[model samples]
Target chain A: MESVILQIAARHMRPLLVILSLVVLYRGHNEPGGGFIGGLMLGAAYILFAMGFGVQKTQKSIPVSPVILTGIGLLLALASGLIAVLMGHVFMTGEWTTLFSGTSFELKLGTPLLFDLGVYFTVAGMLMLVMFSIMEE
Target chain B: MLVLPILLPLFFMVVLIFTRRWLAFQQIFSLLATVILTFFSAMLLIDVQQNGIATMQVGSWIAPYGITLVADLLSAIMLVTVAFIGVVIMIYSPGFIDKGRQSAGYYPLAFGLLMGVNGAFITGDIFNLYVWYEVMLTSSFVLIALGGSAEQLRGSIKYVTINFVASIFFVAAIGILYGLTGTLNMADLAYKLRTIDHIPYINSALMLFFIAFSIKSALFPFFFWLPASYHTPPIPITALFAGTLTKVGIYTMFRFYSLFIVENLVFWKTFIIVIAGLTMTIGVLMAASQYDIRKILSFHIISQVGYMVMGLGIFTVGGIAGAIYFTIHNMLSKTNTFLAGGLVYQRSGSYDLKHLGGLYKASPLLALLFFIPAMSLAGIPPLPGFFGKFFLIKGGFEAGDYVITGVAILVGLFTLFSMVKIWNEAYWKKEPENIKHGRVSRRAIAATSLLALAVILLGLFAGPVSQITLEAANQVVFPEMYINAVLGR
Candidate 1:
């Protein structure tokens, strides 16, 4: 009975933290939160998940290594910078547009925001990698 | 292709993360990627030389709205130089990084570091520069503390703490610059700075930027963290950090000094001149007293940085050109020397000069290999370091700063003295029986030898390289060209 309770407790926490991390990441553009803080929280989620599920099960749940995540983050980040050049702007110039065709409006993304997202993945991935290596020890 | 060099590594770094079981495969792939990067960077250099400036916009975004990656001649030359060092270090890593010591995370972090460095060189915005600096810093923190020894942890904590403080200051500087100019673009900032009257706020911002950069470059006052942290890492890691990391700080300093902040001839210039003189003397004095090989090398890093910064302080084309050339020459020589020292440490299980005597007896080729780079680092003639010093001194004289020129020459002599100390203690001295040392691996020796050979080759081929540096200097001296090129004006 105790084991079952512990398992249930562990099971819900991982997804909860990951979702929370994404929330923090999403609200980063104009809010107090940003990539570095949000990604660190996300990495903490991975560690909690791994601790509860064991390294093997955690590895299966997130099959991608932290390295690949970091690389992709790098790609995303550089892509954000290059997007400016494509728009006929100087390098790293922030490009933005708002979307409101009729009455409804939505906040459109820009390179700085994209850069933030890239940083999010990079920090998250790097933190996970470091934690994983420490666990191996 | 501009994005390809950066993106390919980004791609591979991701793939390697999942393929943790194939660590060896990841290493090979990353090395191949770097080689291709070097080639692409070379092509880009040629293109920029012929075409003026190569600007690329990702996802087809128009100007001022999207980020741009500009490869001016200056940036391209840095890219090539960085790639050259990356390839050599990659080649050397496999032999030096033992399997027991290797982690699934090392290669990816290294690639990530390369991405940060390359991105920093290529980006045209100040905010983006800060972003890349974080990228590089975070990866470096991981690499330094990877093994997680007590010393490594301590060193990393100090390194991270200082750098984190510096990064905060850097972000503040960027914010101030943006608020002042209303734009984050480098070319745009240059134009705004020229048009705006000299204000007190601008001077304060300049000082803020200078303090932040000084910490990053480990200039005299902010240099304590370097010796404390640098000597804690494994030798190859130390070699990479010593060669590349601080130099990036210096690169940014050169860029900003050349483009944005040229007005303060009396205050900033005089201040830097005094700091450079003190940095050189203090650094060499520290090096002369160190018993450990790594510590000595670490001190020399500070002294050489002084030379490069002195060129910037002079604010002449020749001086700046010399700084550029000296930076490249120092990167190669320092990396090679540190890597060779690593090989020696691996053989002896220690880095102390007392414990590492008579290395020449068991490994004559390794001794010879270390000797060449050491001499180059000492600024021996017919080598890259020699020309770097020559150009710097010439620039100093041309600027009519004869007093600083005299100090630079004296620093050069001290540099030779420290190099000879290493030579005499490590190679020429007799082996104490207990410290005779075990045999070094052939592969390690081979890697060091290759780097040594490259140093000599760079020295011999200084003419063409000097031309490239000179052109880069010209670009830096004339901010209008950079602004016009970037803005398509």
Candidate 2:
């Protein structure tokens, strides 16, 4: 169902799109790009792959089912909220910890980032699940 | 913590999701989770009763800025009621739902719906309420079509379409509200609304809210989707929804009405009264004509919701208290009636009353189980429904709304007639020829009996329960108390 040129383009675009989506997801804590946008990009990569390659081939490449990925994503998001409960803070209060603080290259991590990552996986998985189900059908 | 009722469901949702492959594990774990949810919800209610209103700021943020989870008496009561219903549904599901369906993410989806309902009940911010509504809708969209039956799928399409429209209206209203008040926190919005009395868009936003909540709660004009879609799902799922879903809309309506829009109080009260009258009259009249058990009960849900709204329209402490009590009573009895209908279907292999007969002779226990909730719903003396009606009517008369009170009284008669119609057709008549009976699960039957007992106890302890609801109503009727609790003003 696919042309050779289209297939070649999808093959290169898939990895690049995934890398861009991951970058978007990581920088989402402080910048404008966040889980939702990154998740869409990740999902778009799969959708592109599915369109170029056959549905069965794309299914074979996915390591886990989209449904399970959504479950894992929900768990991660819930765990991020639970962190505050554990620290004797209110539920969902963001707890930030500095990584490489004294160095010139310092990064900050927090539950908000974890929550964004969860949203990232959830949206990606949900999008893939819907798109794949439709395409396969 | 006040947040536990909302969080417990999410935790169980993940557990159920990972365990969806094992039906046995999912069932047991779900049951345990519902039990814990109920316990915690009851504890919250007790805490709210002992020490005034309880508010928890999510993530340790300030009340006006962050999402606040408030467990005032009203939310606490609703939490307990919803959680109790969840426990009953979890117990009832294992027996009613097939193994294949159970393994196909039923438990997880059910908990997802629960999480949404709990979140909706306790959220102190208006936008958070909308988010929870989406959560509930997403789970419901799947759950309604879970069986993959042709008719079920068809019904789900209508259900999904109608609810999405309601959500659009809801979100649009929120947009207007946020634009007008510059705040999303309900308490803060209420405080701001009092100072700005000249805004005309407030009515439009409120009208939008009324339409949205009315649709979600399935009031008279917007009720067609409920009876059409509710019967398509299996009995346990239908009963789960029958007990919890519409009440969320009603809860929000009460919350918003009691707290916001003080400038239009008289107008909203009159509008609510008119809607309440039409809703009850139309809803009961529709129920009187339905032959199918689930359809009858489904229509009855609309009528009973009218009673709650009527209580709201009465606009007194007694009236709102009555509405709260009526809500709790309806949750128990309505779910009980649906489960009893499921049992009838189990023993007779049909939901159509015309094809059903002689259950009184065949199973007196089932007959008794059906009788208790049915009579309670019909508002028989010494039942909670009677007291619910009593409170609402007394409050209505006190408020000098005799016409609506009369409508409420007459609706009671029609409600009784419908209950009697089912009683006669399903239990009193002889068994129809060629009827095939399936084995009824003892666990499901036990769950039904336990729910019926709750109805009975609600009546027996009406004195104490009413006292609590009245206190809750005091907070509901006064926005200052709620705002003070939330903002420490």
Candidate 3:
């Protein structure tokens, strides 16, 4: 019964770690952490999942394969900057638009943060992909 | 222009990570992305040629506050070269890497390396340059150590250790520079450096910075790590490193020398010239004895890097231009040579020249492709390689640095000898009984032939090519245009 309880705890830990990694990735722009460290943290989280769940099950859980994840990360980062051109701004020029009916906090989204997220995904995918391939070998 | 290079690659790296299942889709997207980047880089180059400079600020932060991506002719030229080679390499990697589970990591690391390379090129902030250098270095670490062979691991540890030490020194140099100049913006530092007189600590700071760059560039005493470790990686990865990584370091060195260090001219001039001569002589002598094709090519990286540095030492406009031209030619020729070697290894299953023979009999097209770059590398006339060397030698002679010119010419001959040696052993000689040749892959041949065609194209189009080079050269020499562009005059 204790063993079952421990298994349940382990099952809950994966999503918890993923959430923690996201927090770290998001807070990186202002404080001590940034995209690179955040990505590495996320990579480690995936590694833990793979270790606990086994490579096959972990592979099943992650929607995209590691290689594709890297590609996606790359595209995200590029798109963040490319949006400037769409707005008739210079390439990589940050375009921020304040969207609210009145003077109230709503949602803030800009290309730089978007670029940071792209970096996070790329580094995370790349590190784990490398780690997994090497470990498999 | 500045942010696009870094952010574009960053975006693609992310996209690649999540979309790993679609291998064909990923390849198509990566190629498409590279084409887009090439168009962007070409536009930047043309813009720089016509308008003089382009700059972009991140987060709408003013100069000295937010990170700036500045593209003078020099940076734009490098971006174009990088995009051209990167596109070719991306196309070529598919042919050589074989479909495998490991490709998931390979594609991302490739983009990551590109991310670092472009980042290092366009960054206007000195601290940001260090960050980009780390990006490039760490990505290279993963790429080189990917297979984790006993030899590869050994090579990686050494590579990482050396580069890590260099990174420490790099950061330390930045710290010292910031302390002295009170600014991390390169143009600001240049402005500050000029106003200060005989500053006792400034020369020492410059020396520290020089040491950091020299170590990264593998100049003379700093070069042992390169030949020791480069051969251990798989060939395509080695090709990437040989073609791009150290050249990034050299580019950084060129950028800084023209900007802040121009204050104390005589000191750096003498120091760089001495190192250039030694680097050329030592790299060639070592290449003469190496048996492995990759190792031989690795040594030539140092030798060829010396020619570029020699141009730096001469300190004339033409001399600097020569260095710029030589750098572009060397990047293409060296990468082409390495890729060809990879194909040979793929076919014959060994890179040892002694073990390689009878390849010419089995494959004539491969031999022809190999010969084009090899002869060009030897600086034979009508090749861009020849023109690259010609401009540098002319610059050196014009500067009346006859001794340096002599060294450059001698190195050219040795480069020929080494190329001929590979030709004799790997191509012309009969394959030993143990050596077996099979039908080489069409994809491998196709990729190599494409690069071979480029070497010829660069040769035939020397006029426009050199014009681009001269424009980059002028931008490096006169950086005010860059400063003004980034920080409104």
Q: Which candidate has the top score in lDDT?
A: 2
Model 3, span B151-215: residue lDDT tens: 98899999999998888888888888888777988877777667776555877777788888888
Choose the strongest candidate by TM-score.
2
Question: Which lDDT tens digits does candidate 2 get at residues A30-78?
Answer: 7889999999999999889989997789878889888888888899999
Per-residue error at A104 for model 1, in Å?
12
Quick one: RMSD of model 3?
3.6
> In model 1, how large is the Cα lDDT of residue A33?
86
Mind sharing the TM-score for model 3? 0.88
> Candidate 2 on B1-489: residue-level lDDT in tens?
888887789888987777778888888898899999999999989999999999988888897998888889999999999999998998888888888778878999999999999999999999999999999999998899996889998999999999999999999999998887789999988887877757667889989998999999998699999999999988999999999999999999999998875876788888899999999999999999999999999999999999999999988998999999999999999999999999998888999988999999989999999999999999997999999999999999999999999999999999999999999999999988888778999989988988999999999999999999999999999878889888877
Report the TM-score of the second chain of model 3 against its true counterpart.
Answer: 0.97
- The TM-score values for the models, in the order shown, are 0.88, 0.97, 0.88
DockQ of all models, two decimals each: 0.26, 0.85, 0.40
lDDT of each: 0.81, 0.91, 0.83
List of clashing residue pairs for candidate 2: A91-B59, A92-B59, A93-B59
Better of 2 and 3 by TM-score: 2
lDDT of 1 by residue, B87-125 (tens): 887777877776645653777777778888888888877
Best by DockQ: 2
Using lDDT as the measure, what is the rank order of every candidate, best first?
Answer: 2, 3, 1
Q: What does candidate 1 score on TM? A: 0.88
